[model samples]
Target: MGLPGEMRVVEISGPGGPEVLVPAVRKVPQPAAGEILIRVRAAGVNRPDLLQRAGSYAPPPGASDLPGLEAAGEVAAVGAGVSRWKVGDEVCALLPGGGYAEYVVTPADHALPVPEPLGMIEAAGLCETFFTVWSNVFERGRLTAGESLLIHGGSSGIGTTAIQIARARGVRVFVTAGTEAKCHACLELGAEMAINHREADFVAAVKDATGGRGVDVILDMVGGDYLPRDVRALAPDGRLVMIAHQKGAEVSMNFSLVMVKRLTITGSTLRPQSVEAKARIAEGLFREVWPLLDTGRIAPVIAESYPLEQAAEAHARLESGQVAGKIILEVA
Candidate 1:
């Protein structure tokens, strides 16, 4: 595809609060080799998006500085050496950065065909949460059938996705939420146990639910003080995958627990991953996970959708930490 002269995009002029996000018309990006140009219809606002805006998370070198990470749109054009997708394909993609725009370019390998039942809003909501869960919890953590998985922040996008994925695979899921209502919502989504973190110790509740066996895997986004409790909640030979440290990153924890239990700890970020790595993930999802999506075994849970221009308001809602599922930005 040939280059475009200009585009409309949401730009973060500086590191600051949500007020810093501005919608502006800029030069439209051209699709390079192995890339495709998408006329984005919707974009997903994720926790990392906020972190990037706050200056704590920076896009890797050569990636776009724009804040959005996941998007669903129709392909406008395809670059040289790309054959799998062509112009007019309705696709959703996991982008490293630069998704908050009317038109954005992504590696063709990262563009996935949207499941027929999912609309643009739902498709846009898929990438970040699902990618994070599939990579960290399922792939790295090696969560298996009949095993127990505990996810912190059950009401948010990642938590909701993890709960559903684990449940679909026949694993018993336990989640922690800030309120009784959130806990109830997690149970409604098929979680075996939903603990109110504000009122109960998740360690005790999970231990009780598992009959002292502890959980086999944990998807923890809250770092800092939760680290010790997470280790305490894990079973022998368990895995704990840390995706973020919303409270704080650094913490002091005992080494004896890890050594004695033989727990595995690892994590990966989608944005900085190479094209080949993302392609592998896309392939794995298409073969193993997409069928589940089409069969209605797993679905995107969208809590709200805001017009692309009201992104600031969307950010405010996400910052409140009260959303029940994924928040979306409708670009069209």
Candidate 2:
């Protein structure tokens, strides 16, 4: 099949709000060596996309200015030295940028076969959150079986994924959400406990829950005021992995507590990582996590989906703080 010379896309018209995500068209991207061009069937909406739209984030060097970070589709073309996939293979991939289009190009190593019995919509939601969770929670945080983890945003895409993967591997999971309904959703997804942060202090709750031992690790997205509280919520040698700061980033943190508790504080943004590093994460997902997805042990909790053209609406839904899981943009 011949690839189109141009394709449809939703580009950031300006840096402000969800209304800036306007439908447009762009030339279809072509794959380079070790890359594959995908006819994108669906794209996942994430917080990073929101940041990019708000002019707070920018695509890494040599990446498209488009906002999306992950997508699922069929392989339309393969570049030189790309033999792992062929034309017509279905895959979900972690993109550097440019997923909000009908076509996108990403390294072949970043793409994985669509897991059994799941279509493009679910597959589209897989790579970004799974990669973030695996690299942050397991590799960086060193969370292991029998350990206890406290996730700050339990109802989010990353939170839900972390809960399932940690639980499936024998780790106990706890999460904090803003609402009771969100708490229930997290509980249903294998979280051992769900704390409504709006009603109670998470630090107190964690200390009480663990008999004052605190948690083995904390996956925190809320920074600022939560830093001091998180220090109080961790056990000796506990790890805290921050993936974002919905709250402000600047904080007056006391290193004394960190030293006394022997704690580790770290965080990462997935978009700017090297392709080689991302490929390693992809390998881990294929070996350790794909089976769970294939067997239906854990699935993408799709809160809602919108047509490709309704990207503004999708972004609005995500920002509304009412969504429990992923928001997908259907392209095909």
Candidate 3:
């Protein structure tokens, strides 16, 4: 069957709030060389999407203006030089941008087969957080088996993923959440300790849990005031990978503390990364993590889902701070 001439999409109608995500129609994107077009079934809502909508983050040059970083769907077309996927293959891909539509195009290597255990909605939430965590927590942070790790935003999609993967790999996991319920959720997800940040300082709790040695690695998204405290919570030779600074990026911190602790502070935002870099992350996930997912040892935690047209509502829900996991928009 021939493809449609146009498809439904939600565009960022100028920078503002959720209401700026308005419904529209656009021509179905054609797959370029080594690229594949996906007929999107569902898309994940992420903090980066919110930032893009707010005008703080802009789509990379030559990328779509739409605001989606991950999506799951079936192959609708395959571009020249693409061999790994064909039309109708179900895939969930780490997209550079332009996922907020009925169809989207991305490099073939950036797409992975939707694990046998996950459906479209579940798979939609996989790429962004999984890629982020795997790269930041394991590759950049150099977290290893038998080490201790601390994750901020323990109830978030990235936090839940890091908990399971770390536990499965024999790393002790600790997490911080704003509420008791969120803490409980993290604990259930294999965190050895979930500290309710509202009740106790995470640094002190992690130090106490680790017998005052501090953790080996810290994955933080909240910058601002938490910066110096993150330093205090690290063991000697610890690594801190900052993937997001939701509170604000500019902050005062003690570099001397970082130097004395022999800490490595590094971070990467996925969107601006090269396609080859993301492909490497995808390869790592397939080699090391897919089996756990296939066996149900780890799964995507979906907090809520809304129909495609209700993207505004979905964004509002995610920004509401009540969601403990990923929010999805079902497009199929």
Ranking by lDDT: 2, 3, 1
**Model 1 spans > 4 angstroms off:** 1-4
Residue 179's lDDT within candidate 3 is 86
Q: What is each predicted model's overall lDDT from 0 to 1?
A: 0.89, 0.94, 0.93
Give the per-residue lDDT digits (tens) of candidate 3, residues 78-121.
99999899999999999989889999999999999998988999
Among the numbered candidates, top lDDT falls to 2
Tens digits of lDDT, candidate 1, 191-298:
989999988999999999888989999888898899999999999999989988888989998979999999888777777788898888888788878888877888
Which regions in candidate 2 have their CA more than 4 angstroms from the true location? Answer: none
Expressed as tens digits, the lDDT of each residue in 1-332 for candidate 2 is 58889999999999999999999989998899999999999999999999999999988999999988999999999999999999999999999999999999999999999999799999999999999999999999999999999999999999999999999999989899999999999999999899999999999888898999999999999898998899999999999999999998988878898999999999998888999999999999999999999999988888899999999999999999999999999999
All-Cα superposition RMSD per candidate: 1.4, 0.8, 0.8
CA deviation > 4 Å runs, candidate 3:
none
Candidate 3 TM-score over all chains jointly: 0.98
